[model samples]
Target: MLVSLAIATANQPPNIVFVLADDLGYNDVSYHGSEIQTPNLDKLAIEGVRLENYYVQQVCSPTRSQLLSGRYQIHTGLQHSYIGVAQPNCLPTEIPILPQWLKNVGYATHMVGKWHLGFYKKACLPQNRGFDSFFGYHSGSEDYYTHFRGGYGVSFDDRDHWLGYDFWDNDVPFWSAISNYSVFVFNDRVNQVIDKHNKSKPLFLYLPFQSVHSPLQVPKQYQEPYKNITNNNRRIYAGMTSCMDEAIGNVVEKLKTADLWNNTVFVFSTDNGGQILEGGNNWPLRGWKASYWEGGLRGVGFVHSDLLPSDVRGTINKQLIHVSDWLPTLVNGVAGYPLNYTNLDGFNMWDIINSNKTSPRKELLHNIDPWPYQPKDFNTNMTSAIRVGDWKLLTGTPGANNGQWIAPPGSGITPHLPLTIPGQNVWLFNITADPYEEMELSEKYPTVVKTLLAKLDTYYKDSVPVRYPDDSDQANPALHNGTWAPWE
Candidate 1:
């Protein structure tokens, strides 16, 4: 039995290990009928409850910010795009974030892998944000082996910069792992953290892995399994994914070996949809990442733990879960912690996860990004979208019709086939009836579209100004001794 937070007791609350994958698509894993094999993810997901209707933002930092802040991007002024490598902004420090809350309750917090949230100031770094230890990159993406990030353009203000090492340990730059595969380095570090953890105290491990994202690089051995794949990009991407799966399997093994598995709630999710142009396929799910389509926003997620009710284990939960729900759900509902924090956009979803109760959440604000957008090529079109119950509304281009159904390599299907959906600025869909968004009904259901638009206006009125800034020359890693570190 878990101990109540009110009184310090012998029984410890369950340890939480949240693993986030970067740019993983709904169709990338074998469980979802993809050609890529994700044996470890498949095994663990089947043993746990699968989140069929799970959703996340269409990009990296927005989903991550909402996950940690327990609030929408509009609330945090991060509604535009991801935190650029040379951008001066970070997730607002005024807002209390996840690790700090868990640490306040006595969990020993450790972070490994990506920290794309923000690192413009020392206070915004992970260590200052309540993590006892931090190991990872502060930027969005980088070379897997060299640990070097390119394309900063802030390189001496030349707009083409030399690669700089981005790996770190806590607030300091780490170089020992340079040229070593990042996934392996992270996996090893996770084992060390698990092995050194004190069993009497609860643990909070947040691993936002840089797997399956880009740079399309993985160890050659992992790629051997997919040499049969004809498409070069898909083959490499498959290898990167398989490598990430192995790391997860290893972490689970480490937990069991340390006797920490029994009391651990293992949650796995993707930051957003795949980048189809970069060898990702969200077949039959609309568009790819950076779009407003279901393929971009609907995420692949699952939770595994011994704490789930036995009857619900190994079943599918169709609850309308969103990325922002983790914070309140973990604190108030699962850990039995009081609701000391308020003004949150997320709901306490623990009951829905554990007991299979109907989710208290009926509405979700997907995003209100200001930039004009279309996936295939750039064009200006507003993409403010929202969902209420069975209805979903999108203002501007949904970006679903660009080369639809880019299948995995050697699937006997040709590539670059276009979807026939016409371009429209406003679309309304009964999502429950059309999960794939096969039909747009803005004209048919004029009232519903009008109502949802009004709701969006209310949210827009409450949103903070968007904080995206030009890539600062001051953020040049060359200025920070060739490592991405806090400059301010």
Candidate 2:
């Protein structure tokens, strides 16, 4: 009996599996009352702790940078926007990332799908950033079937466009003739990783699925269920999301088969909120992907594990969690400590999560940057937002506009336009009372507005300058050549 107990206890440190959905909205999942069916995600929420107020950056790479470093994106040299494929901008190598921390603790780290952080040089690739294995695309978005960047004036029919193929297996170009939808292909790679994982050692699997992003693509079988949805863009978006849901189901089944289900802590979340242009609906919430509104910053998230106390499971956690929190949470979960690292913007909410207690976090600095990467013609500085308790303040322009729901490609929909303020030039709201941000309360409570603005000013002073402006012409060569090379 003692020998058997030791054998079982050998695998005590739970494996960590983080699943990130690209551009999934608050209302996109079935659990959130969207028409789209996400039974797998719903099941996870039912079996785990659902975070109601989980927040991320308003865009992709910013959130990703914070997620990995546990530092604010501004500190990570990714202050304003996503990294362009050919742009020299990248997550600074000096900062310690989550994978590197986990690796130090004897965990085998593997990343599968969508490494949008940087690819200008091999030094910035995922494998160089402490991931032992990496399999996926390097660009922000790619064709689901062809595995190439779209809308760069590069036709699939053109031979030159083949150079734009972005799929890779650990820095090596994956030019295999295998033609399958990217969602399924990524899932297949994940399954393989799970199957081959060393049972004795802990596994840290970061699976960032390229689902529900632009260039909406899904297999016919996945699309069949959403045929009743009349709108073409929405129908396609639903199908893409459903495909991701099924992929999640497959991963869960794999965990069960491997007997790693109970000993694994699984987290599911989106990088940011939905993009309105890509048929994403964060309805009733103020703004879309690039805006600082709750619709763009607040994301759907849940954590499930048998290790969680029974009382905490199947409960809604109203904690004010940030994307940066994951690094510390997982590091603490695995009983790992980082050396020579003290400052982190994220707080470890494991105690609050497991005990069903209120979050220790009370304030969130949403963002303090100009509009991220818009067309030169429509470029305008976006207002910054800060949330403290129930009070929220917006500086500059809020950029709320009513426009085309499903925006055409390259339409340049400027979401944030300057709101006319009588004297203060700021918008204030009690988010708890008015989640939609319909009513401004700056005039009603001048003191509260003043306090929040002071706090924003402090953050602004410490914030790092933007590393690369979004509208630079440096990426023009790659856009014209239909490929990105480090030497270019």
Candidate 3:
């Protein structure tokens, strides 16, 4: 009986290890029908709950801001990607980040890989924000070989001097010539951090792997595992994904070896839906990473905790939860901490998760600024969208028609607001019945559109769009056009 009691207590309040994969698509994992053999991820899903309807912002920065702050991007002043030192980039200090909140409850917090929220010196980097230790780049993306380009540039501007390398260990310069194996290197670092933490205390580990993003390069071992696949894109993508899965397995093994597995709660997910075009498989879902479609925002999410009701194990949750829900959820459910943090649009999904309730969200919002450099026709801009239950309303150019902007009649910019004012783009949709958003019914439902549009107006008025530095285009070469932003 005592042994049984110990086993039951072992699984409660488990260490929360949140692993994020870069640009991973929905169908990339074998469990999701991908040719890739992601044993680690597959094992987690098989053993734990898999959230089928999890959602996040389309792009990286906004998603990062939402995940860390437990609020919408608009509330954090990071509605758009932080383009280098342009304007006031990165997540602002006013927002309470996940690590800070977790640390308050005596959880040792550590972040390894990709802190793309902001790139300015001293003001918005991960270490300053809340993370106790950060090992990664501070930009959007990094070159696999040269360590240049991508969303982040070749260099990072440290407070005193412009740091030559984009990599760092909490502010101290860290270098790795093994550009091709950056993900592997970061995984090692994450393991080291985990090993360093005190076993008795809870820990919040944020491992955001920069794998499968771009400049696709994978170790030969991971590649060999997927050689059976004939398609080169799928094969390579599978290899990269498999490598990350192995890394995850390694970390989980460490936890088990340390006897910390049962005490830890692990949440695994991607920043956004994977890229559909570049060997990414958002199977059965419409839209890619950048569009306001189901694939781009919906991701694979799983929460494993002994504290959850026994029925939750191996269960499937279809709740309308988003990235912003993590902070409050963890605080309320895991840490036994109280958070009076207000102005947050996310809800605690604890009750829904525990009771297996089908309580759908009354409404949700998706706002993305125009990726101007994306050959205007091939990308979206300044769109204000809302998801109410199963219906989603989009105002602005529905940048979904193969990147071609679709302007519905009477859905133009407010005449009084200047085009440069930002957040003018808008649209609406009935998402539940038509998740793909193939049909636009804004014309038929005028009153619903008007009500949602008013909500957007209030949100926009309260929030400020990320301002591009006057010299952003010139300063950031990637911003020149088309190139995906690299985390420097």
lDDT of each: 0.84, 0.76, 0.67
Please, what are the lDDT tens digits per residue for candidate 3 over residues 1-488? Answer: 22342366553344788888888887777887666788888888867778887888887777878888888876665665444533335577677788888888777888998887766547577777778888887664566544454323424342222223456677755655435477767878877887798866678899888877876667677778766666566677778888888888998888888777766778887887676545676755666677766777778778766556677788888878888888777776666577786777777766676667764467777874543442222122446567777777665553334322221112242222112224434445677776655566766887887777676666666665545443233335333232222233
lDDT of 1 by residue, 15-111 (tens): 9999999999989999999989999999999999999989999999999999999999989989887888778889999998888888767899999
TM-score for predicted model 1 compared with the true structure? 0.94
Model 2 earns a TM-score of 0.88
Q: Give the per-residue lDDT of model 2 (tens digit) for 390-488.
A: 988877554435211222222344444325445454778898888777777888998997898778777766766668733334343345344443432
| Clashes per model (N, Cα, C within 3 A) | 1, 2, 35
Q: Considering every candidate listed, which one attains the maximal lDDT?
A: 1
lDDT value for candidate 2?
Answer: 0.76
TM-score of each model, in listed order = 0.94, 0.88, 0.82
Write down the RMSD of candidate 1 (Cα, Å): 3.6
lDDT of 3 at 125: 75
Error of model 3, residue 220, in angstroms: 2.6
Query: Model 3 segments beyond 4 Å from truth?
Result: 1-13, 85-88, 145-164, 176-180, 228-230, 358-360, 368-382, 400-428, 471-488
Better of 1 and 3 by TM-score: 1
Clash list (residue pairs), candidate 2: 399-416, 399-417
- Candidate 2 stretches with Cα past 4 Å from truth are 1-11, 150-163, 334-340, 370-382, 400-424, 469-485
